[model samples]
Target: MLAKVLLLCCACAAALAAPGVYDAVGYAAPAYAAPAYAHAIAAPAVAHYAAPAYAAPVVKAVAAPVVHAEPIDPNPAYSFSYGVSDPHTGDQKDAAETLQNGVVHGSYSLVEPDGHLRRVTYTADKINGFNAVVERTGAAHGAAVAVAPVAKVVAPAPVAVAAPVARYTLPVAGHPWG
Candidate 1:
């Protein structure tokens, strides 16, 4: 048993020492050649480092700007509509809606490869009240509402409850025995 324990200790020490010795040898040499050892070090010394002759700077010709007489709208109404049509179940659903001001608003929907419908809605705040409802038959449903500002709510403080105390009682004998 003593010999076996010594053998195990030696095995663990060898395993721990192997990685340290291996890393020291693996990283000992540098990959790049030193500047003093390079043969091209003397080549640059023979060539003189001098600037070339100066030339006159050339000026680029500018073109005249063209102006249009027609006026264009800065904020154009962007309206788009899309829908998702499932190929497996043959169920079509609306996915997204986009609206810019009162002039334009649209919806879009798309069906994923796994028979899932994805919907999106985009609407401008120019309208008074806007509500969007997205429903997936059996998977998930969501709703969004835009309402006028309402009163703020404050929660009441919680009431504290007293903890119960454990009581112990000793039994009394009816008659004393000698």
Candidate 2:
């Protein structure tokens, strides 16, 4: 459709530009002889196009070295420590753990919920659940004595509350929303 419209517009432009086509009313168009056909001096034919070939890149593949990891320690005695800083409040925490005779024990110090520094001592094992003891202490970098964990069972206060009613809105207008 577009090509047809373009061809039509070109033909109309050519007709308007022709000398004989621009005629005055009541006057016949001037006779202009058609152009005589003449053969053009021949041009040599264009040679066939050929693309230049490219060589493939050469790559050398290397075999990875055979790696041997260190053997696992059979003895159950080991110690480790870690420390981290609180990005927002600039608080610091340091914790360490020691495994001796298959019993695991650790201590950690951190800022308490009340913004006071506190230290926690704990012992844990697979069979027995972790038992911890917390004590208010100096801040990080302050001298603190190592305290042994005591198996103290403190009972919590019991409380009761009534059940809730009318806490939620019901579905409306045939939709599961309110």
Candidate 3:
């Protein structure tokens, strides 16, 4: 095995030192110079082909016909109201909005986390970007108190005792062959 490994290493070193490979460091000299020819060999002449002259077809963009679309009503009037009340969790919220004459007026109310009711009235228009009035009604009860859970104690069931079992062994006798 050792001899084989040494031979492989030697072969690899010879291959790496060959000419034209790893010559950037100028360590290995070229193996041999290229042979010179008596006369220079000329390349065969190939006929040149010129692409046929082509002019892109003239394309004129005709102006699309002017179309006048029906204008929409900018000052539309609309009203909507929505509310949600969950008695189990005591969550309540409602909102109402109305848009008239390019003006939006809306109001929303919700139960706050502190048990207080918060209401906001807002109005928006071109002159006044947005105006809102917030009002908090009812006293703040604060966070709800958490009650510790109680563990119930259960009595263990009675276990019935099993009767004792009896075992008997017969005396060994001499074998008939013996």
User: Which candidate number has the best lDDT?
Assistant: 3
TM-score of each: 0.25, 0.33, 0.40
Summarize candidate 2's per-residue lDDT along 1-112 as a digit string, tens digits: 9999999999999987775443433334544454455865554453333344568999989999999998987766989999989779767799999998677999999875
* TM-score of candidate 1 relative to the true fold: 0.25
The count of backbone overlaps in candidate 2 is 0
- By TM-score, how accurate is candidate 3? 0.40
Candidate RMSDs in order: 25.2, 16.7, 24.8
Instruction: Report lDDT per candidate.
Output: 0.56, 0.76, 0.83
**Tens digit of per-residue lDDT, candidate 3, span 1-178:** 9999999999999988765455444444434444567887654443333344579999999999999999988768999999999999888999999999989999999997778899999999999899999999998686676669989989899899998988898889999999
Higher-scoring candidate on TM-score, 1 or 2: 2
On residues 85-107, what C-alpha lDDT tens digit does candidate 1 reach at each position?
66687667664444444544445
> Which has the higher lDDT value, candidate number 1 or candidate number 2?
2
Off by over 4 Å in 3: 1-71, 141-178
How many clashing pairs does model 1 include? 15
